[model samples]
Target: MRIILALLSGTLFGAGLVISGMADPGRVRAFLDLFGRWDPTLAFVMGGAIVPMAIAWTVQRRLESPLGDKAFSLPETRGIDTRLAVGAILFGIGWGLGGLCPGPAIASLSLSPVAVAPFVLAMFAGMGLHRLFTR
Candidate 1:
C-alpha cells in the first residue's frame, strides 16, 4: 500500500540521515561554519542528493503517465511571488537556526531527542497560523 511504502521511505530516509552524520546539529553547523572549522562534506551530501533528484525529475518529465494514472499529476504555478519568497526565507532561517527541518526533525525526535520538540511545535503553530490566515 501507499501508506506502508511511505512509512518505509521515511524509515530509510531517517536511517540515511543518521548514518551520514546529518542528524547531529553540531555536524551540520560545522558544515555551515565556513572559514571556521569548515567541513565540505555537507556540500557533498547535498550534491549527492541533488544528482538522484535531478535524474528522477528528468525522467519523470518525459513520462506520459503512471501505471494507473491517466497523466502525471503536477502543479502549475503562475510564477514565483512574494508569498513564496517570504515562506522560503522563513524556512531558510529556521533550518539555519535549528539545523533540522521537518523531515529530519521528526525523524530525530523518534530517537528521544529533546531538542526537536520546540522546532516541531513552532512548525505546527506556524502551519496553523498560515491556515487561519488563508482561510
Candidate 2:
C-alpha cells in the first residue's frame, strides 16, 4: 500500500512537471535568468505547489501518523549551518550552469535522452559520492 501510494505520488509529480513545461531545461533556465529574458511561468507552478504543501504540513502537525506510515519521519534539522549554506550554494551553481535541477532533469530524461542522460548520470554519481563522504 505504501509503495503504491509512493509510486502514484511520483507519477503525479512527474506529470505536473511535464504539463507545466518544467521538464524543459530552457524554461527552467529562463526562470532563473534574472537579468536576461526572464520567464515567470515556473514561479506560478511553484506557488501552486506551495499551497498544497503548506496544507499538508499543517495536517501533518496534527497527525500522529500518515495513512501509509507508522509514524511521520519528518526532518529534525533546525537553524542554518555551514553544510546547509554550502549545499545550497553548490545546488544553485549546478542549477544555474546545468539549467535543470534533479526533479526536472530526471523528468526530462525520456524527452531528451541525448542531453539529459548525462545530467542524470552525473546526478546519480554525485549522490553516490555524497553518501560515501557522509557515511
Candidate 3:
C-alpha cells in the first residue's frame, strides 16, 4: 500500500513538472537567468507549490502520524551549518549549469533519455560520493 501510494505520488509530481514546463532545461535556465531574459513562470510555479505545502505543514503538526506511517519522518537538523551552506551552494551551481534539479531531471528522463541520462548518472554519482566521504 505504501509503495503504491509512493508511486502514485511520484507520478503525479512528474506529471506536474512536465505540464508546468519544468522538465524543459531551457525553461529552467531561462527562469534562473536574472540579468538576462528572465522568465517568471517558475516563480509562479514555486509560489503555487508553497501555498499547498504551507497548508500541509500546518495539517502535519495537528496529526500524530501521517497516513500509513508510524510517524512523520522529517529532517532533524534545524541549523545553517557549514555543511548545509556548502551543500546549498553546490546545489545552486549544479542547477544553474545543468538547468535541471533532481525532480525535474528525473521527470525529464523519459522525455529525453539521451540528454538527461548523463545528468541523472552524475547526480547519483555525486550522492554516492557524498555518502562515501561523509561516512
Candidate 4:
C-alpha cells in the first residue's frame, strides 16, 4: 500500500510538472532568461511544488509514524557543510546555464531529442562522484 501510494504520488507530481510547462527545458530556460523572455510560469510551478512538501512536513510532524514505518526516515544532518556549499554552487551554475535540475531534467527526458540525454548522464555522474568524494 505504501509502495502504491508512493507511485501514485510520483505520477501526480510528474503530471503536475508536465501540465505546468516545467517538463520542457525551453520553458525552464525562458524562466531563467530574465533579461530576455522572463517567464513567470516557473513561479507558479514553484509554488505548486512547495505547497505539498510544506503540507507533508506539517502533517508528518504531528504523526508518530508513517504508513508501515515505526518512524519517519529522515535526513540525519542539519548543519551547514562543504558538501552543501559545493552542491549549491554547482547546482546554481548549472541551473543558470542550462535552466534544469535533476527532477525537471528527468521529466524533460521524454522529449528524447538528443540534447537532454547527455545532460542527464552528466548529472548522474556528478551525483555519483559527489557521493564517492564526500564519503
Looking at candidate 4, the ten consecutive residues that score lowest on lDDT are: 104-113
Tens-digit lDDT string for candidate 3 (29-125): 9999999999999999999999989999999999999886889999886889999999999999999999999999999997999999999999999
For model 4, state the Cα shift of residue 129 in Å: 1.3
lDDT of 2 by residue, 25-84 (tens): 888899998899999998999899898999999999999899999998878979999989
Error of 2 at 129 (Å): 0.9
Worst 10 residues of 3 by lDDT: 68-77
Model 4 alpha-carbon drift over 4 Å, by segment: none
Sequence-dependent TM-score of model 2? 0.93
Clashes of each: 0, 0, 0, 0
Best by TM-score: 3
lDDT of each candidate versus the true structure? 0.82, 0.91, 0.95, 0.81
- Which pairs, if any, clash in model 3? none
Q: Candidate 2's C-alpha lDDT?
A: 0.91
lDDT of candidate 1 over 36-69, digit per residue (tens): 9987777888889998889989998888874445
What TM-score goes with each of the models? Answer: 0.83, 0.93, 0.95, 0.83
Tell me the lDDT of model 1 at 85.
93
User: How far does residue 51 in candidate 1 sit from its true spot (Å)?
Assistant: 2.7
